[model samples]
Target: MKMNNYYLELFEGRKNIIILPHILPDGDTIGSSIALFYALKKLEKRVYIILNDKLPSNLKFLNANSKIITTEDFEKLSIKPDLIITVDSSDTDRLGDRAYLLDLCSEVLNIDHHSTNTNYGKYNLVNSKAAACGEIIYELLKKLKIYIDKNIATALYVALSTDTGSFKYSNTTPLTLRIAADLIEKGIDFSFINTELYQNKPINKIKLLSDVLNSLELHFDGKLAVIYVTNDMLKKNKIDISDTDGIIEYARDIEGVNIAVLLKEFSDNTIKVSLRSKYDFDVSIIAKKFGGGGHKKAAGCTIYDTIDNAKNILLNTFRENFR
Candidate 1:
C-alpha cells in the first residue's frame, strides 16, 4: 500500500505538524512515532510528539534525541498545528486527552494497522494486513522517496519486533522478517536490542513477575488463566506500572491454557484487563464489549470494577464465547 498522496500533498508547504502515539505507549506506538518524526524532520518540517506519560524505561534508547513533549507542553503552546498525524492508534479515544488536539488541526492523517481502526482522520492510511504500523510507515517512506537513516531503521525494527513478539506471534509474516532483515542490513545491533527489551529485567520487575505468577489462577477446566497485579504489590516491590509489561505472557504460556487474562489493579477504581488467546477465539470481541479494541489474538479493556469482579466478568465472557 502506497502513501496516500492526498495527505502528502497536504504535507507540502505545511510547517507546524504534530505526531501522536496512543497513551500508555508501547513499542509499536513509540517506534512508529519516532520513525515518522525523524522522516518529517529531514523534510525540515517543524514537528513535535505529544506524549501523555514518560517514555517507557526499556524504550528510552529510542528517544536518543529527546524531542517528545508532554500534553501539558502542548496545552501551553499558543500555536495550533496545521497537521496532526496519529500512528498506531485504533481510535481517537486512545489518544487520551490529546484527542482534543485533533479538532484544532485543519488536517489529520491517521496511520494504523489495527483492524478496528475508526478512520477518524481526514486522510487515513490503514493497512490491517501489515504486521505493524512501522511497516506501513516504511512503505510510506518508500512512496515519498525518503532516505531511511540508521536511526529510522532502528525505530522501525523496534516497532516490528515488539508488536510481533520478536517474530514469534501469529501476526509475524514473511514480509515482517524481510523488513527485519533489511533493517539488520542497515547495521542495527539486533542482539543488543533483543537483550535490552527481553533480557534486561530489573530486580524489581523480577520480583513483580514472581508475585504475579504466584497470584495466577486457572479457570474453566484449565483453559482460562488469570493473573492479578495490585498497587500493593508494586508498592512492596518498588516497581513502577511499566514493570508489569509482558507479565501476562507467563499465564498465556501455560500448557493447556487457551486464554490468559491479566487483571491489573490500579490506584483508581478501574481495573485494566489484558487478554491473550492461543487460537481461534477472538479476544478483540471481548475487549470491544468493555469499550476497548485491539487485534484478534491480543486485546485489552479497562473494567471499572474491583479486580475480582473484572476477573469474573472476563473469565465468564471467555467461557460464553469459547466454551
Candidate 2:
C-alpha cells in the first residue's frame, strides 16, 4: 500500500476521511492536518480532522477550521470512516480516546517525523529527517497533484517553522528550508505566522515563565539546567501545562548550558520531562531509559511518580553518560 503510487485512484474514491493528531496538538499537528483537510475537501472529498486537545489560539486561522472535531464530539458520532490519517502521533495511545476511530476506518495512514515513532498504523511514513509532519503532508499533496495556494502554504509554514524552532533547531535540514522556501514563495506571510505563534504569549504565561526561570537549577557544571512546575504552580498562575511550552528553550539558550530539562507535574502527580541538547547528546537515549522517546536533540518522557524520583534518575544517568 504505497501512497506514492496510488495518488490517482485514491483521490477518486469519495471516502469519509478522518484525520487525527496526538494529544495536546502542536503547530505541526494543526498545520499538517489543516493542509491535508483543505486539499481533500477542495477535491470534493469528505474529510474531517479530530484533535486530541483544543486548538491553540494562534493556529485557529487555517481555512478549514470548522472541520476539526474534538474527542468529545467524535464520541457522539455514528459514522464509519473510509480512511484514518494520523499526523504527528507516533503511537495509537497518543490519539487518546480517538484510538477507537481506527476501528471505524478501512485504512490507516500514519504520518510523522518523530524519531521515536512506533509506526503503529496500517501505513507509516515516518521520516525522522523531516522537520515536521507538515513537511510530509506537503509532499503528499504534491504527490496527489494538489495545488498549494496562500492558505495551504500558511498552514504548512506554521508546522515546519514552530517544530524546527523557527529554523534554529538542529532538525532544520536543507530540505526543511526548501519546503519553507516553497511555502513562502506561495505568498504566506512569514511575519504574521511568526508573531502569531511566538510573540503572542499570554501575560500570565510570561509571568509563570519568569518564575520557572528564577527557580531553575543546574547540574554537572551547568551542562543540564532543570526546571520544575508542579500542579501547585499551575494553580498559582491559573495556567495549564500548555503554558510551559517555551521554558525548555529558555534553559537550552542559557550560556554554557549543553542540555536542558523541564520537569512538568500533571494534576495526577505524574512528572513529565522534556530534554534538549546543544550537540549530539542524544536526548532520545535518555528519554528511552524512562519509557519514552523522541528526537536526538529534543525528546521527552513521563514518569508516573514524583519529580524527585525522575530527577534523581536523570541526574544519576547524566553522571553516567556525560560525566
Candidate 3:
C-alpha cells in the first residue's frame, strides 16, 4: 500500500490485514507487532498477527495473545488479506513457511529496524537508527492518537529491553530511554516483566546452554569465539532449536572476544550463522554479503552448506574488511 501517512497507509481500503514477524521471533519482533496489533484493533481493523516461531512466554500478557495466527494457521487460511504488514522481517525470505502470506495480501507494508533490511514490501519504513521496531511502532501509534495503555506499554517495553540489551547496547539513545520512561509510567509492571522476560528460561534451555558453552572454541588471536551446535548436539542434549537460544550470548561474553558466531546445523548440510560484534564492526555488511541482513552489532544468515565453509567465508571477509 502506498501510504503517505503511516497509519492511514496500513488501512488503505483494507478490512482484513495480516501482520507477520520474522522467523525465530525475538522480543522486538513480537513486541513491535503486538503494539501495532493493539492500535490496529482499536481502529477496529481486522488484523491477524502471524508468527512462524513459538511465542516467547514473556509476551503472553499482551492484548493480542489469543489473536496470534501461527504458521500452521497461515497455511490453512484460504482467504487472502487486503493488507499485510510485516514487522522486524529483514526480507521476504525471512518469513520462512509463511512467505506465502506476503503473496496473499493485496498490499504489503514492511516495518523494521535492521541496517541490512532488503525493503521487500510495497511500502516500507525501515529505520536503522531506532533501537527497536517497537519504538517505531510506538511512534506510529502516537501519530494515530492511540492511547497509552498498560498492555501496549508493556509490549513496547519488552521490545526496547531486548533490542537495547536492557539499555546496555550502543543502540540505546536518549530518546529511546525517554520513550521507555513514558511506557513505564503507563502502569506496566517493570519488575515482573523484567524477571519474566529475562529470568524465566526453561530448564532444558539452561542445560543446553551449559553444554554449548563448555564446547566453545576460540580462534584468530582470541578475537573470535565460535560455538558449534550440531544435530548430534541437539539430539544428545534432548533439546531442539529453542534450547539453543542464548548460546551465542555466552560466547560473546568471553573476555577479549570482539566477535561471536553461533553455528547451528540444520537440515541437509545447511548451517545458520549468527554474528554479534562488540566493537565498531558492521556485522550487517558481512551478513549482507552472505545474502543476510540485520543491525551492525548483530546480524545473521542461513548458509546452505557446511559450518567450515561458512566460517571461512566470514573470516576472509572480516580480514578484508577490518584487517
The candidate scoring highest on TM-score is: 1
Q: What is the lDDT of residue 28 in candidate 2?
A: 86
For model 3, the stretches where C-alpha displacement exceeds 4 angstroms are 1-9, 57-65, 75-77, 321-323
Per-residue accuracy of model 2 over 1-323 as CA lDDT, tens digit each: 23467544555676678888777677888888888888998888777788656565566556445877776676687667777888898677678777888887657888888888888877788888788988888888888889998888998998998899999987888999999999999998899889888888878788788778887999888888999887877788887776577678889888999999999886475788899998778999998887778889988877877888878878988898765
lDDT of each: 0.86, 0.81, 0.80
Clashes by residue pair, model 3: none
Clashes of 1: 0
Cα RMSD to the true fold for all candidates: 1.5, 2.1, 2.4
Best by lDDT: 1
User: Residue 231 in model 3: shift from native, Å?
Assistant: 2.7
Residues 181-263 of candidate 1: C-alpha lDDT, one tens digit per residue: 99899898999898877888788888888888999899888988999999999899997776687888999999999889998
Clashing pairs in 1: none
TM-score of 2: 0.93
Query: What is the TM-score of each predicted model, taking all chains together?
Result: 0.96, 0.93, 0.92
Error of 1 at 162 (Å): 0.1
lDDT of 3 by residue, 1-323 (tens): 12247555557567788888887777888888888788788888887888756665555555445878776776687667888898998888788888876767658888888877777888888887899998888887877778978888998998999888888999999989999999999989999888887788777667677777877878888888888888877787676674465568888888998989898887667888899999987787778877888888999988888877877777777777545
